[model samples]
Target chain A: MTYCVGLLVNAGMVLLSDTRTNAGLDNIATYRKMFVFEDPGERVITILTAGSLSVTQTTIARLKDAVRGPDVDAETSIMLAPTLLRVAEIIGNTLAAVRADVDEKLVAMGQGVSASMIVAGQRRGGEMRMFLIYPEGNFIEATEDTPFLQIGEHKYGKPILDRVVTPATSLADAQKAVLLSMDSTLRSNLSVGMPLDLAVIERDACRVTLRRRIEAGDPGFRAMSDAWSKALRDGFAQITL
Target chain B: MTYCVGLLVNAGMVLLSDTRTNAGLDNIATYRKMFVFEDPGERVITILTAGSLSVTQTTIARLKDAVRGPDVDAETSIMLAPTLLRVAEIIGNTLAAVRADVDEKLVAMGQGVSASMIVAGQRRGGEMRMFLIYPEGNFIEATEDTPFLQIGEHKYGKPILDRVVTPATSLADAQKAVLLSMDSTLRSNLSVGMPLDLAVIERDACRVTLRRRIEAGDPGFRAMSDAWSKALRDGFAQITL
Candidate 1:
């Protein structure tokens, strides 16, 4: 299980994901779920994945291979796509193909493989965009009314996002929103563990402005989580019955 | 769908449930999910139901018939049960039986039936108790470390309860905890809706101390929801990035 969120706010996009994976209670492991591709002033794309590690890892490997391939084109590679939407399509296709290939082998053993991802980035002159790509390859974009997308163990962390996020929210506040959102999930769900990857893309910059890997016991994250918990307790006490 | 919560606090017990029921998106209606059975000065039991309405409604009906039957005994009737645990067993068995009966009829049509319940109460001279009864009739109790049980669309309302509820929490605070919990579910889930039923049982009283049905526009409920939303937004604003 995992928890990843992608936010499309006015100041830019914020992507956060946990690094936990498990076969069951006894086989838990940490794995990075966020991937970044930046051609500086040309284009910048970030992917946050959740679900089967095999499918996501393979899909990512294929994407990287495509980037390194000599025949790279707008139609074949996310890095060369003309629009953020096309990048999502290329990634979605690759994810679906990899999942199908893996499922074919695992299905016979009574096991299965599947995965989903959040694609967020910008192309030099195009609008910044974010998408939640399904395992089947279909995708949905973040709109003004609902400026955030989340996958895996989403419910525990959703109410806060529903209340606080909007397209006009600033990058700093957006970062706080995603971090606090991840904090709620980490507390309620054991499958979503720490050492998180966080990335922030300033609007039209075509590059990630802020990137962070929050390890367990990191002072800044500890202080923020402690403060949020205390604030909730204090706020709860202040409300009249 | 439904959202019902039962809390076992030191002061007594608090049970709260939403009233919305929906067969599908276009087939939504309001129906109470909280059922209270009280023999003043003797025993007081509250049942909060969630899942297939057919199964829950039928189970409640059968339990009522058993209580009113002429040949009622300790094994056949909840009112005559020796302990709160026995009462939970009676309700669970009844629910399981009713579900099986309904499933038998629905199976031919390629449908199924199942339901879950939270049974909370106290018998005179007995300790206050709460149990979450599964569809199979197996049940688990709320202990000192975890003094709350929730059923149906539970995730949205869980974080607050997880943060604030305890066996030593006061009755006043307990009531606030549940109402606020229900408020969170209502905001996030369309299937769990307005007009909530709330009940409180004081320790050793063997009868309900307070019972109220909060309508959609009730001033007190509105105030509480408004206060909670404001508090969350304020807290979000105050947090450092």
Candidate 2:
């Protein structure tokens, strides 16, 4: 189980993901689920994954291979794709292929593997876009009315995002919104653990403006979490039932 | 798809349930999910159900039959049970039996049915008790550390309960907590809908002290929901990144 969120606002895009991965409760491991590919001022693509680790890792590895291949083309490589939509198509196809390949081996045991990802990025002239890619190779984009996309263990963290996020929200507030969303998830679920990866892309920058790895006990994250909890408690106490 | 919660605080017990039930997204209808049986000032038992409509409705019907049966005894009837635990056992066993009967008929269709329930009440001279009865007849009681039990579409409503509910929480506050919790679920899920059933049982009263049916346009519930949303938004705005 994992929790990853991608938010696209007028100011920029914010991506947050937890590092915990588990085949079962007893076999838990920490794995980075966020991948960044960039050509600086030309283009920047950040991928946040959740679900079967094998499928996600293999799909990402394949995408990386395509980027480094000598015959790199827009059709085969996300980095060279002409638009964010094309990039999403390439990643989605790769993810679906990898999942199918993995599922075949697990089928005999009545098991199957699958994964989904959030693709957030921009090209120099293309508008910033965020997509939620399904395991079957299809995707849905974030729209002005609904500026956020979440994958895996999403329900616990969703109420806050539904209440606070909007297309016109500032980049700083978007960061806070995603972090607090993750906080709610972490407290409610054990499978989503600490040491999170956070990335912020300023609009039209074509590069990540802020990157953070929040480890357990990190003072800043801890302070923000504590403050949010206190504020909620105070707010709750004030409500006249 | 339903949302039902039972909370036990020092002051008493509170039970809340959404009236929505659905066979699928296209086949939704309103159905009561909360049932109360009380021998006033002696014993009171409130059951909040969730899951397969067929299974839950059947289980409740059977329990009611046993209560009104001429051969009623502690072994077969919840109302005649010697203790709150005994009542839970009767309910759990009946639920499991009904589920097994229903599952058998659905198995040929490659489908199965199951349901769960939260039973809360106190018997004369017995301690107040709350139990979450699983489909297989097993049950777990809510304790001081976790004074609440929820069934069906629970995650969306859990964070608030986690933060606000405790054994020492006042009855009035507990009512607010459960209502706000339901408010969150109602907003996040389409399957959980309006016309909620709320029941409060004050300590030692052994009967429902307050009961209300909150329709879709109920003014008091609307005001509380609106105030809670505002409080949450304000709290989110005050948090710093």
The DockQ figures for the candidates are: 0.73, 0.83
What lDDT would each prediction earn against the true structure? 0.91, 0.93
Model 1 lDDT per residue over B104-178, tens place: 999899999789999998988999999999998989999998899999999888888888888889998899999
TM-score of 2: 0.99
lDDT of 2 by residue, B1-241 (tens): 9899999999999999999988779988999999999889999999999999889889999999999989888898888888888899999999999999999999999998889999999988888999999999999999999999999999999999999899999999999999999999999899999999999999989999999999999899999888888888888788777
Q: Give the per-residue lDDT digits (tens) of candidate 1, residues A25-109.
A: 9999999999999999789999999999999999999999899898887787888877788889899999999999999998889
TM-score of chain A of each: 0.98, 0.99
- Identify the candidate with maximal TM-score: 2
Winner by lDDT: 2
lDDT (Cα, tens digit) per residue for candidate 2, span A115-218: 99999999999999999999999999999999999999999999999888999999989999999999999999999999999999999999999999999999
- Residue A137 lDDT, candidate 1, scale 0-100: 95
> Which candidate's DockQ is highest?
2
Model 2: residue B228 alpha-carbon error in angstroms: 1.4
